[model samples]
Target: MLNLKNYLCCLLLGVVFASPIFAQVPVQKNTFSGGITVTNNGISLLPTFTLGKPAAIFDFAVKSKRWSFEPQLRFSLEGKPWSFVFWGRYKVIDD
Candidate 1:
């Protein structure tokens, strides 16, 4: 199973490449965007079974130029933690 450390590494790599200091192309002004989603089951890529629990998922992002900082949070109705994912994205091609 993938661990938090592995995910962190990937996020870091993206952030490094997406830094404005290194980007050559012109980028748009900063923008804030986010949304919420409700799900019936909080399954984690398992083909066998599901959690069968109701969950609330939140996704938010701050974007500027060719880079964006997006973070996602998931939790059960009972206030239990499901998962947390953070993504740093860079636009390599704008076509």
Candidate 2:
């Protein structure tokens, strides 16, 4: 089975790249996203025994014509730890 971190990385990359593919729909200035991740004995890449380790992720994005801000939260669904991430982006001389 794949490790949790690697699996989550791939999932996030997929979400980021897949956004433009849905361009036929109207774009929203604010967006919210969420997902669940699960793994077995591969949470930290070390050799340990764990089963059905699950986590939940929540993210929100605020977008304008030339700037964006995103904040994300991730926590264990099974009473584990949690973390938060924030991102800011701006367009500089878009062509």
Candidate 3:
């Protein structure tokens, strides 16, 4: 009967330690996403490629809780920097 008692105690300890694995976390925390784009002359009314020099653009964003920061950077193909833009945002209303 000693073996049976030891087995029951081990099972109880395992269940107590593993309970937190079943919990759920909020969806709007510690999120990161980004993209790389290659184009010419930025966004234009007419999407013509042959009219200007080629460029590469980088965009990325990081979000945590109710705040987020996004940045956009651009550069030409010949190693010339073009522009930089930063967006800082906060959630005022929740849907």
Best candidate, TM-score-wise?
1
Among these predictions, the greatest lDDT belongs to 1
Error of 1 at 76 (Å): 0.5
Ordered from best to worst lDDT, the candidate numbers read 1, 3, 2
Q: Order the candidates by TM-score, highest first — what do you get?
A: 1, 3, 2
lDDT for each residue of candidate 2 in 1-95, tens digit (9 for 90 to 100): 56998999999999998988766866645544544544442243233422235665566777676778887665677655555667899989753
lDDT of 1 by residue, 1-95 (tens): 47888999999998987787776876557999999988888765454534578988888999887899999887888888777878999999864
Query: Would you estimate the TM-scores of all the predictions?
Result: 0.60, 0.43, 0.58
- Candidate 2: C-alpha RMSD to true structure equals 23.9
Task: List candidate 3 stretches off by more than 4 Å.
Answer: 1-28, 44-52
Clashes of 3: 0
**C-alpha RMSD values across all candidates:** 22.5, 23.9, 6.1
- True-structure lDDT of candidate 3: 0.78
